[model samples]
Each structure stands twice: as C-alpha cells, then as structure tokens.
Target: MIRTFFTAVLCGLLFVSCNQQQNTTSEQSATQATEANVYGASFDAENVISVTQLQDAVAATDSVSATVTAEIVESCQSKGCWMDVRLADNSTMKVTFRDYGFFLPVEDLKGKTVVFTGTAKREVISVDDQRHYAEDAGKSAEEIAAITEPREELRFVADGVKLQ
Candidate 1:
C-alpha cells in the first residue's frame, strides 16, 4: 500500500512540474512577441538592401524609397528620434522616423543591426540643425559649439524599424 501511495505521489508531482513548465513556456512566448515588435509597423526583412545599395540608389537620383539594413552607429540620446547607420563604404546615413509616427528606444541601440523601410533623400542639413541634433545627442557644450558647416548627407525617413 505504501509503495502504491509513493508512486501516485511521484506521478502527481511530475504532472504538476510539467504543467508549470508549460505555463512558463507560454509566458516566455508572450514576452518574446512583445519584445520583437516595435513602433507598430511590421518590419519586413525580405526586401531589405544593404546600405551600399541604398547609397548607390540615392546617388543615382535625389531620393528613393527602400528597405535598408545597417548597423546603428548612434541614436538620439534624448528621444531616439533619429539614428545613424553605417554604410558599406565606412560612411554613415542618418535615419529619421516617418511623420513623427514612432520612436525607437533611446537606450542600448548603438552597434545593433536594424532593418528599416523608408524614403531616403540627400539633404543639406544646416548648421543650426546640426547643433540641435548634437544637443539632442547630449554632446558636450564644446562639441555642440563646434558645428559650423552644413552637412550634405543621406537622410532616411523610416515608416518602420526593427532591431535584428
């Protein structure tokens, strides 16, 4: 009788343990889903082109809409309103959110690879705008003050962005 009782208890414990593990797995799945999607718009990685391709397209014309994949060189430290991504030729392109629709997390984005769908344009950013961006990035006063010339750069306005 004792042996039967012990076996029943062991089976019961195993069942309970298995049930708990299933719950934990479901919870983890939910958490992963939450983390994977950001800024509402879905990120499609299938059509993403390298920064080099984007640069070539932009150079061929003034602007083009494209899906691009690149490494985040830096992001707006204050609000994540903008980001800079590295290009294949060791250059960087500035990326902005589309229509002020969404923002990225302002922390821990540097050096991360991300895919973005957006329009890329070649723009001349004025010195005042450069200074403003520097301030937003929390640059030192001297760094902010060092801005003197306008920057001719490739700028992207992204409708959607996803960290990879």
Candidate 2:
C-alpha cells in the first residue's frame, strides 16, 4: 500500500511538471520581440549581409539568395502581407513571404529591425499593383493616384523572417 501511494504521488508530480504552462500571452508576445520570434521556415540568422550588399548582388543578376537585416520603412497595414524595408542607400525594398505561407501581425511596424532569409531580386511593379499596395498601406487617394507609373525596384521574397 505504501508503494502504491508513492507511485501515485510520483505520477502526479510528473504530470504537473509536464503540463507546465508557457507565458505566451498575446500582450507579451506582441510587445516582446526577440530572436525567438521566428516566422515561416526557420533559418539561422548568422552570416547576415546588409541590405546594400543584397542590392548590389541583385543589380547584376536575376536574384541572389541571402540573409539580410533591414529596418522597416512601412508594413502592410491591412494584413501584414508585405513590408517595405529601408536599404542602406535610403531606398526601400519590398519583402514578401514565400508562397503566402505566413503573415505578420497587422500593426505599425515602422522603424523596426527585421532579419530575413530569402531571394532578393529586381522586378518592375505594375502601376495597378503599386496602387494596390498603397491602398493596403492606408495611403490617401492622392498618394495612390500618384503611382501611375510602373516602378523598377528591388524586391525580396523571404522564406523566413525573425522579428527583432
């Protein structure tokens, strides 16, 4: 009978320890960003290149695979579907998730530093698409209409993103 009671206590203790809850409240997660907050496919954030190096690499080729750290100039306000991260030369490059697989929280993420791994390429965005992005960003009618011309710009499709 003593052995049975001891075994029962041990099992209870194991259950309690195994079921320990994590502090993952939304408030904590939203406000607390670290290297642990990884979105999409996981990749090491090491050996990261600056956005300028990524730009130069793609300037001569169709695309280049790299991990880049950049500051957010703007983010998709409606759905967090895309972000315009600032480059070293003051230009912004659009970064989108690979395969539309993951999305960031819809919030004002301007000036936030983000590290991402993916393929950077140069692409010409159509006027219609540009207007769509402007609208998604909550731009005014005047701002959206001003994007009448197609833009040749640097673009990145990130497979993984680490929010910092």
Candidate 3:
C-alpha cells in the first residue's frame, strides 16, 4: 500500500510540474508577442529606395550601382537585420547590409517599400539553415522542414538602404 501511495504521489508531482512548465512557457510567449507588436509599426520601403537611388548616383558615380525598390515580403524576427523583398517583376531578393553594418526591425518594415543599392547574386538558402530559421520563427518541426522552396536570389550585401 505504501509503495502504491508513493508511486501515485510521484506521478502527481510530475503532473503538477509539467503543468507549471507549460503555463510558464505560455506566459513567456504571450509577453514576447506583446512586446513584438508594440515595436512593430508600418514603414514604407519603396520611398526609402527613391531617396537612396539619388544619393547613390552622387556618392557612387564611379562604382557599379544597382538600385532597387521593392516591398518587403518577409524577414527575420530575432533581429530586423535581413529581409526578403518582392520586386515589381514578381521576383524576391534577400537584402542585407554590407558587412552586417546596418539593421532594421523586420516587424516595422515588413510589407513596406525599401530602396537599396548593392550587388545581387543567385544563391541557395541551405535546407538545414532554412529549417533552423523556421524553427526560430516558432514554426512546428514538420512545417520547418516542409519549406523546400528555393529562394531565387540574394543581394550579397548592400552598402546603402533607404527605408521609407
């Protein structure tokens, strides 16, 4: 009888502990969501690009310049560092600052118009890292791996980006 009682107590304790853990996780997620929403505000990227193109013409007259204006389709939430922008041509391009010099909040800028100057290159977003990114974005494990679509091109890095 004592052994059965002890086993039951242990099971009860484990259940309570698990419940507490789950509650803590839920609370933390809620807090994070609130914080993210508070910091997210709409900003147009296209207007930023128009200003950047004019500045680039004067600053980089001798250098190779590619100025693009596009709408940010997606971005990393952890750091507003990089984003995927959809061009008018219906193609997406990853834009990141040169040498990781600059960053902007993704939530505030996503779906906004942005103009940037940089060199672009076709590259592959690795499957492993892509899965990791999806996980970080709070996607389920199955959802992470299910994203197998290849991103066509990435702007290697940009020297200047104007966000409107």
What TM-score, computed on C-alpha atoms, does each candidate reach? 0.77, 0.78, 0.52
Give RMSD (Å) of candidate 3 vs. truth.
14.0
Count of steric clashes across candidates, in order: 0, 0, 8
lDDT (10s digit) by residue, model 1, range 1-164: 99999999999999999999999999978966876755636765687799999988989997899988899988998888999899888788889898778888879688898989989999999999999988988899999989999989889999988887
**lDDT comparing candidate 3 with the true structure:** 0.61
Candidates sorted by lDDT, descending order? 2, 1, 3
Question: Which portions of model 2 miss their true places by more than 4 Å?
Answer: 1-36
Q: What does candidate 2 score in Cα RMSD to the true structure?
A: 5.0
Q: Candidate 3 lDDT, tens digit per residue, 26-143?
A: 9989876654422222223332343234334434443334666667777767776677777545655566666777666646466777666666554677777667666644578779
Q: After superposition on all CA atoms, what RMSD does each candidate show versus the true structure?
A: 8.5, 5.0, 14.0
- In the predicted model 2, the residue pairs found to clash are none
Query: lDDT by residue for model 2 over 7-119, one digit each (tens)?
Result: 99999998776665333465456654553578788888899999988878888899999999999999999988999999888989999999999888788889889999999
Superposed Cα deviation of residue 4, candidate 1 (Å)? 59
Q: Sort the candidates on TM-score, descending order.
A: 2, 1, 3
lDDT of 2 at 38: 80
